[model samples]
Target: MSSDASSPLAEPAPAAGGGGRLVLGCTPIGNPGDASPRLLAALAGADVVAAEDTRRLHRLCAALGVTPAGRVTSYHEHNEDTRTADLVAAVQAGHTVLLVTDAGMPSVSDPGYRLVRACGEAGLAVTALPGPSAVLTALALSGLPSDRFAFEGFAPRKPGERARAFAGLADERRTLVFFESPHRTAATLQAMAEGFGAERPAAVCRELTKTYEEVVRAPLGELAAWAAEREVRGEVCLVVAGAPAATGGDADPAALVREVLLRVEDGERLKDAAAAVAQRSGVAKRELYDLAVRRRAE
Candidate 1:
C-alpha cells in the first residue's frame, strides 16, 4: 500500500454500523516512524477526524502516506469547548470519530478530555490506539529512578506561582516528570532547585527521538547553571529525583530553624515558614522557632 496521503488509494470498507465509537489515536512525538499501523488504519477509516492542529495532522498524514477518508476538523484548546459537542454528535449519528493531537495521545496535556468525558456520559463506546509518548520515553531515558513517578504537565508561567507549585511537590518521594518550554526551562529548574533542594538529582531530556536530541543528567543546581549559560531549545522534559527518604528520628532542630529563616528571608512569614519546614522535616515548629530565637540572641 502506497502510504502517500495525496496519492489516490482504495479506501477500506467501512465497519458495520451498530453505534458510533470514539477512538483516541496517538501520533508520533517527533519521528514519523514511531506511528503504529493501527493508528494509520484508524486515521484512514474514521468518519470524522478531529485534530489539535489541522495542518500538523495533514503533515503527519502526508508523511505516513495515508490520507484520512473522513472530514478533518480543527479541535484545539481555543475551540475545544465548542467543537467537542459537534464531534460527539457525529459519533451519536453512527459515525466513527477519531481524536488526535499534534503529538502523543489525546488528553495528555492536550485537547480531547471534554469530548472523552462527553462520550462516556452518553454511554458511547470509546477506545484508544496507543503509540509514541514523550513522557514514558523521557522517563526511560532519564537516569533517575522511574519505578514510581508523577507527570506535572507544565509549570506556571509566573515565578511566584511556579515556586509555590514546586513547593507543594517539595516532598514528593517518587520521581517527578514535567514538560517545560525551552525558554522557561532554566527558570523552572532554578525554582525547583530552591524548592526541592539544590542538590536534588534531575535529568533534562530535550528533543526526544530527534536529530539534535540531548539528555543532560545532573543535580538541579548544576542544571540551572548550565541552562543559564546557554540557549536551550526544543521540547523539554524534566525528570527530577524525589526527596530523600526521611529518617525515623527527628530532624535536627538547628537545621530546621535555619531552613525556616531562609524561607523568611525569601519573604515567607516566619510562622508559616516554620510550619512548612516542620511538616516537611518531621520537627516540631514551636521547638524550632524557640531554638531560632535563642540562636538569634547569641
Candidate 2:
C-alpha cells in the first residue's frame, strides 16, 4: 500500500473491459494456511498462468491440491515486458490469465506490475486475489509506529547511490521497511548503520513465516557486525526505527533560531531548511521554522 497521492500502481480499474479474464492472484507470503479459496479457484480455472517462478507455482498448486489446467508462462522481472501483451490479449479475448509471483502480491516488488499496468491501460478487467504481503507482515511484527511507513523494496546496489538514498530519508519520522538479498545483507546493513546511525534500533526479520525463520532484534551497528560475520539465507526484511525525538530543552531556542534563519536566507525551501535544523539541533521542525521566521522579522 503506497501512500503516494497519485499511486499509479496500487489501484487498478477492474471494470474497464476484457470480460473479466485477467486475474491477479496473491499467494501466501509465509504460512501456506494463509492461502485463500480465491487463490485455489484461480489456480484451477486460469486458462494461462503467468508465474514469476514456474517451479514454485507447481509446488504451491500441489500444496493446495490444485492441478492447473492453464499454460504456465514465465513472467518475471527478466521477461515481464515482452510477455505482458500476450497475457493481456489472452484475458481480453475471454481467457482467464492468472498472474502469480514467486510469493506475496504481484506488483509490490514483483513481476505483476507490468501486466497490471498494461491491463489498466488496456481497459481490461484486472481483478485481484489478495492473500498475504511481507511488507505489512514485517511492519506488524516490528512493533514500531505503523500509522505511517514507507516500503523501499530494495536499496541501490552501488554504495554512492545508496548513501544518497539513505540521506534523503534521514529525516523521515515514520518507520521504514525494506527487502534485501541475503548475499548483500551485510553490505546493506552496514550502509544503513552508517547512513541512519549505528545506534538506531532495528529488527532483522529473515525467512519470515517459513520454517527455520529467524528474527534478530538489536541496534543497527550490532546487526551490521553480526551480518558480516556469517552467511544469511532466505528473504530479508529490515525494519528500522524512526528518527529520535527532539532534545529542544537542552539548547538556546533564540540562538538556534538566528542560525536557522540565516540558512533559509541562503535560499533553501522552508520545509527542507526546517528539516535540517531539526536534525542538527534535535528541535521540532514546527517550532524552529516558526522561530526562524520571527527572528528574521525582528
Candidate 3:
C-alpha cells in the first residue's frame, strides 16, 4: 500500500530550536517518491514558503498529502530581486522561511541566491535540506569520472557564445557537467564536439529519474549524431570526459607554469588558473603556482 494525500501521516511542526533561519529545501527533480520526510514537514509547517512555482509546489503538496500551514509566495527570476527583501524580512521577524524550487535545490540554475545572500548579510541563519540533484544523478549515471567533476549549470544559448564557453573549458581536466534544453541538445552536442574534439568521451542523460529516462554515452561526435537523428526530449544533462593525461614524458613544470600564465592573461586569477592547468596537465598545483610566482619575479 502506498501513502496518499489523505493518509494519517502526522502533521509536521514548524522548525524549532532556531531563530530567524532560512531553510533551503531541495525538491525532487522528477519522482515525488524522492521527497524527504523532513521536506514534507518543512512544507507543512513553515511560516513562509517561497517557491519558484506555486502551482508546482501545490502539486507536490497534493502528492505528499501535505497542507502548507504557511503563506506561499512566488519566488522566481522575475521577482527574485524584489522578493528577496520581503522574504528576508519574514526571517528577521523570526519566521522559518522555506525556500524551494520547481526541481532540485534553489540557486542551482534557479532563483533563491538573492534571498540566501540577503539572509547571510543580515546575519540570519540559513541552512539546506539536501536532496536529489540532477547534476550528481546524471554524473553518476554518465559512467564518467565523478571523483573530480564540475557542474556548469546551463550552456549559453547562442552558437558563438556557447562555442567560446566550451573552448574556455577545453583544457579542463575534471569531468564537465552541463544542463541543456531538450530542443537544443543536438546542437549543443554538436558544438561541444567542435570545441572539445569529436573523439572526446561524453554522455547525454535525458529525463533522469523519470519515465522514459535515457542515458546515451559515446564519443562527442557519436553523441552529436545520435541526438540529431532523434527528437530528444525531457530535462537533459551532458557529461564530458576530461582531456586525456599527458604521456611520453615526465610532467613539465615549465610548461605547466606557462599554461597557468596564459590562463591568467585570459582573465582568470593566478590561483584559479594554476589550479585548473594543474588538474588538466597533472602538475602539482603548489609547484605550478610557485614556478609562476618565480617567473613573475624574474
Mind giving the per-residue lDDT tens digits that candidate 2 earns over 106-222? Answer: 889887877888888988878888888899888888777889898999999987778667766655788999999999899999988877778888889898889977889888999
Ranking of all predicted structures according to TM-score, beginning with the best and ending with the worst: 1, 3, 2
Which pairs of residues clash in candidate 1, taking residues 3 or more apart in a chain or in different chains? 3-65, 4-65
Best candidate, lDDT-wise? 3
Native-referenced Cα lDDT, model 2: 0.77
Across 1-298, the per-residue lDDT of candidate 1 in tens digits comes to 1222222222323445647889999999999999999999988888777888878888999899998877777788988777777777777777788889998999999998899999999999899998899999999999888899999999999887777677668768999999999999999999988778788999999999899999999999999999999999999999999887765273545545656666776788877888878777777778777777776678
lDDT of 3 by residue, 133-204 (tens): 999999999999989999898999988678667767876889999999999999999999877779989999
| Count of backbone collisions within predicted model 2 | 0
TM-score of 1: 0.86
Candidate 3: Cα lDDT at 97:
88
Give the residue spans of candidate 2 off by over 4 A: 1-18, 245-298
Q: Say which prediction, candidate 1 or candidate 3, comes out ahead on TM-score.
A: 1
Per-model TM against the reference: 0.86, 0.76, 0.79
User: Would you list the C-alpha lDDT of every candidate in the order shown?
Assistant: 0.83, 0.77, 0.84
**Residue pair clashes in candidate 2:** none
